[model samples]
Target: MFDGMVKIVLAGPVGAGKTTTLRSLSDDEPVSTEMPLTDGPMGEKTTTTVALDFSTVMLDDGTPLQMFGLPGQDHFAHMRPIILQGALGVIVLLAADQPDILTMCSEWLDAIQSITPDTPIAIGITRSDQARDFRMDALRALLAERKTTLPVFTIDARDREQAQQLVRALVYSFA
Candidate 1:
């Protein structure tokens, strides 16, 4: 289903778990350009990715996958297409606790798809345990309204298995 290194991009708004997802899935310690969040406090987050978060993970079949996580903040929006270039797939993570979770997902989805149209895209909803009123079905419905249906996973980005699932699902999606 793949040749050479497979590249996938993780994208979403700040505090959406892009960094943690890359960290948990990386086989080796990922190299990240995380700088202190001087702008302000983002919940428990004191650091943020200014450029990109990168790592490599080997699939069970020995295919090396290059993971590139984009900086989620809009100020760094320029990096989105740079990181997304040549990506075979994308996974957009959104925090379920955000009031605009659905809109955020829609925007990220539309943005990425517009940038890398025809690229297989999946979604991972992070911070599910923190959600009080977020609805997954509503998210699904919104995608349906957008004429897009994709694999959606509610994940704790710190968990290797859950994060890995999103990556693997994306890889197989190309097959």
Candidate 2:
């Protein structure tokens, strides 16, 4: 049972589908800070989140969950602490097709742990459909090395069902 709102942070590298995940799970139209991409490796993606993406969804018990997605670019690192404030848990999405996927995951995980060591976390590997030879074991090994045992799922960020499943995993971690 929840009294007020439960906050969750969605964090990851550029083009990792954080915004799409929020849009998929949100009950209403999500508020986005997306701007036209100037120069980046995001390919055809014309826009990228500049500050953050926000949305709210109600759980089966009628509790509202506030989802905040942080900007993925390195330049926005300073905003991470601000966005993470009072967050109940974190959903770290990694682009499986990214060349530096492992490195990005490590960086994000480090940043998250540095800010909220006790908060629960779930890892969602987005773009799995485009990744050839996606290795779950490797990711699990990496988390094991960091001494974190989190629920990891291969998900399509645009799919409502998959996104909700990821959110549910994070919420259940609190229980």
Candidate 3:
């Protein structure tokens, strides 16, 4: 929402790949706020983002995209508004392997929209390849139920091209 910088936030629950996506998409190593998981681990994750992960990348047109990846746990939610204050868009990443992913996705959307209702958002369902019988239609149906349509993609958050697509789609969604 600023004049020259394009700020976007990547958000999701634990193990949703927000950090990995940031690292994958950034040319330079992201400034990560990871710490040992004294709390119980989610999946194979041994650490969690206590605050946020940050990086800046130049888009194809050379626009500077200042990306902030939010911590997945609810406890760190207080940081959301700080990261989102002037964000142009948000890319919510959901891990397909998570139980009740539909509900989680909906919650993330609600949380983001509650703060920045007009911000363009794109959804990326990560780790679909690791989930058996993951039905993307369910997510689509959930969005439909919300009476909204958003760009959604099943992506590997570890892949650069796929992560960049989510970013590009978020920017172009409002263009």
For candidate 3, the clash count comes to 0
Off by over 4 Å in 3: 1-4, 59-63
lDDT of 1 at 157: 97
Q: Per-residue CA lDDT of candidate 1, range 1-175, in tens?
A: 4676579889999899999999998888999999999887887999999999999877788788899999988889888888888888999999999999888988898789888998999899988886878788999899899897788999999999999899777867765
Candidate 2 per-residue C-alpha lDDT over 1-175 given as tens digits, one digit per residue, 9 for 90 to 100: 6986589999998888899998998889899999989885467688999999998877789888789999998898999999897899899999888878788889999999999988899999998887887888888889889887789999988899998888779767865
Winner on lDDT between 1 and 3 is 3
TM-score of each: 0.92, 0.92, 0.92
Candidate order by TM-score, decreasing, is 3, 1, 2
Q: Could you tell me which residue pairs clash in candidate 2?
A: none
C-alpha lDDT of residue 2 in model 2: 94
Q: What stretches of model 2 exceed 4 Å from their correct place?
A: 1-5, 59-63
lDDT of 3 by residue, 7-82 (tens): 8899999888999999998989999999988966755889999989999987677678889999998988899988
